[model samples]
Target: MNKRPSILIVDDEVSNIEILSAVLEEDHDIYFATSGDEAIATARAALPDLILLDVLMPGTDGYEVCTSLKGDPLLADVPVIFTTALGDQEAEVKGLELGAIDYIAKPISPVVVRARVRNHLEMKRMRDDLAKLAVTDALTGLGNRRRLEQALNIETARLALTSGTLSVIILDIDFFKRFNDLYGHTAGDRCLTMVAAALNRAVHHASDLTIRYGGEEFACVLPETEHDRAMDIAHGIRERVEALNIPHSGSDVAATVSVSIGVATAACVPGATPEAWVKAADAELYKAKAAGRNSVSGRTFQVVVEDARPLSSTA
Candidate 1:
């Protein structure tokens, strides 16, 4: 069963908060904030799906609160509805300009409030679903290359500030073309899905992300992980893929489906970029292919060198 969507009712008046809560509590998980500051804090903590905001609260009014919420990257996408007595055109325009999805005038009608809330919540759910689909791979259900690059960039910046380490593993199916040609494209897609699932299972950490990096290739981003552990994870992925037992008679590497993995680990440093990290992993992948398929190659860098120099394998 789906969990109830959460809503935050922000109003200074206890009576108003209670009324909105009673209206929404049956269908939604409801939270109350008596002031704008409290509302902001609660929204950040709870990340409610929808907010019902009163316009005339003391200290920080609904307009200011909505602005703050819209400015926040984490909270910006959350839908906000202004529940206020000021039903004038100017007030509604200002609220909309500040990123509110709807404006509800007081004295509130329970039925209208309920219907609008349901409609807005449903719309938000659809929007969220679409956004997720945009970044997700359709065949493998893993994050797509764009999503992986975005995550890599964000992690690189974060670790740069903390002087931490980040690792990447790039892997591809051995003799995938021959497998596809022999088994047909349909079977090839199934094999790719199976490999993606194995890679996903092998990562095992919430902080790690597995992504489908285009056709027949996948990548894993391991944040705050060092060289040895990264290599272990890569090898584990290789073992898992081989154990899938998907037959690949066209390949010479193994009787069953197998993969080659390349691992690159680096400490965050000046001039480090996500592209360079990926290139390092790609180079290691080249080495893995050179050494023969169904193997893992890895390298660790102390700091990012901006000279575009070739990276040597540490293992």
Candidate 2:
């Protein structure tokens, strides 16, 4: 709320647009796009904090534009307001039903327009920041366990609805305890950071959440990604870390950093709980360690990490 925000005013009539812009300029970074299409394009480009749209226009009107904006994944969160002279109860109801956050009757007062827009923008900023903190792990700046669980729940539900396929991969740095014992905890911290970056890059899909799974381990929650594809991503992370060539006491690559990975995937189908999905991936990670070290193992392969143990949830 303290930061300056960009606001877009969409109207076909030049005078109405100018008046609204003049009213809002001192409070926000204002942009005007006369047509519905132009407004949507500008909204997307600017990622504006708020949108003031005209209900009646020559071609595409505000309702259609609002629906389209709501349908898009990236633009849906930006709040929209219908600004029109149509004061009927039905018109206001329709505008609200079209996913606009508010409707402002035309013959607009600068005070009303500025006040409502500012209030909604403040709410949007607060909501966004709060949602971010809920999803992020404060310690590592990665997705926390709660966020991971939420992502899995949502993804699993979508898969059932859409019949898509996805994979989850779990990885652990082999013999991390002994390495920490030798090089100290600070070096271990550096290793974790490097692996996190590698995982973030290796998983190219925007839907994927690279999570720090507590300590000495991580998980990649990948959607629309299958088993072979998941293994490919895992191998990519493994190879990249090996290339870093950090010396570790007991790893195959030099000595510093080698990771054992386990990947599990499920199709958009019934009978797959998120817990069961991760259990499969966890089993595979242990197999990688048992088969030796410095490798990527899938649910099909049987490898085991030394002192490998399944983690139980405190919840």
Candidate 3:
């Protein structure tokens, strides 16, 4: 079942909190914070869909809270609505400047509050859906290259901070053009879809992203994975795709459809970039293609230095 939208109601007065909760409780999972400090902490923890902030407070007023929330990357997109008794145009402009989507004046009208909350939440839902579609591949329903890059950037940044490991595997359909030439585009598409599913099944973790990187090329981003584990996964992808037994009468590789895979694992260091990480994997893919198709090649970087340059590499 889908979860209810969550709202954080912030007010120093218990009475105001009660009144707001009474109005919104039926439709939303409500969380409360009594002061600005508590509000920021709760917002980080709860990640509420919308925040109803009371402007006047003892310390860390609503404007300050909104500024803090908007500054945070994770919480920035959350909608914040200021509930202020202050009726001046200047005050309203101040709240809007701090990134609050709408302002609800006190003594809060239940009807107006509900309508505004519903509208903003609906708009947020539409935006979230469109963002998902933008990074998704239309053909095989796998994440597209844009999604791959975004995931890689996120993982690389996180690992760089923690000095952890990251891995990437790039896979190419062996003799794919020949397969299309022999089988026609429809069968070729079917083969690609089957291969995508095989890759999906090969990756076990929720954090592992399998992407259709581009025509006949796919990639996987495995965060915090080691070289041996990544190599095992690369080999697993290769075995699974070949097991599908899609005939490839095109010369060489194998009778059934197969893929060439290359993997690169790195112990992340500061200043690492996603582009450098992908290039390392792509270099290995070239080696796999050079040696022969239908094989897996892997390597490891001892440490990624400034600008994602590897300090050392090992086969």
Q: What is the C-alpha RMSD of each candidate to the true structure, in Å?
A: 6.0, 8.4, 5.0
lDDT of 2 at 102: 94
Cα-based lDDT for every prediction: 0.88, 0.80, 0.89
TM-score of each: 0.74, 0.62, 0.80
The numbered model that scores best in TM-score is 3
Model 3 segments more than 4 A misplaced: 9-22, 30-47, 54-73, 157-165, 224-228, 267-271, 302-315
Q: What tens digits encode model 1's per-residue C-alpha lDDT throughout 1-315?
A: 998999999999999999898888988999989999999989977989999999998899999999999976557899999998876999899899989999888999999999999999999999989988988999999998878866776677557767889999999899999999999999999999999989988988888999998899999999999999999999999999989999999888899999988999989864465777788899999899999889999998665456522232222
Compared with the true structure, what per-residue lDDT tens digits does model 2 show for residues 1-315?
566898889999999988998898997998889998998778766878888999999889888999988875457788999998888889889988989999888799888987898899889989989988987766567887777776676676556556677688899988888888888999888877877877787878778998988788889998988778888899998998787777887555446688999988777454345676678889888898888878888853222233312233333
| Better model by lDDT: candidate 2 vs candidate 3 | 3
Residue-level error in angstroms, candidate 1, position 220 = 3.6
Displacement of the residue 138 alpha carbon in candidate 2, Å:
3.9
- The TM-score of predicted model 3 comes to 0.80
* Candidate 1 clashes between residue pairs 3 or more apart in a chain or in different chains: none
Off by over 4 Å in 1: 12-15, 34-38, 58-60, 149-169, 203-209, 221-233, 249-253, 262-293, 296-315
In each prediction, how many residue pairs overlap at the backbone (N, C-alpha, C within less than 3 A)?
0, 13, 0
Rank order by TM-score, top first?
Answer: 3, 1, 2
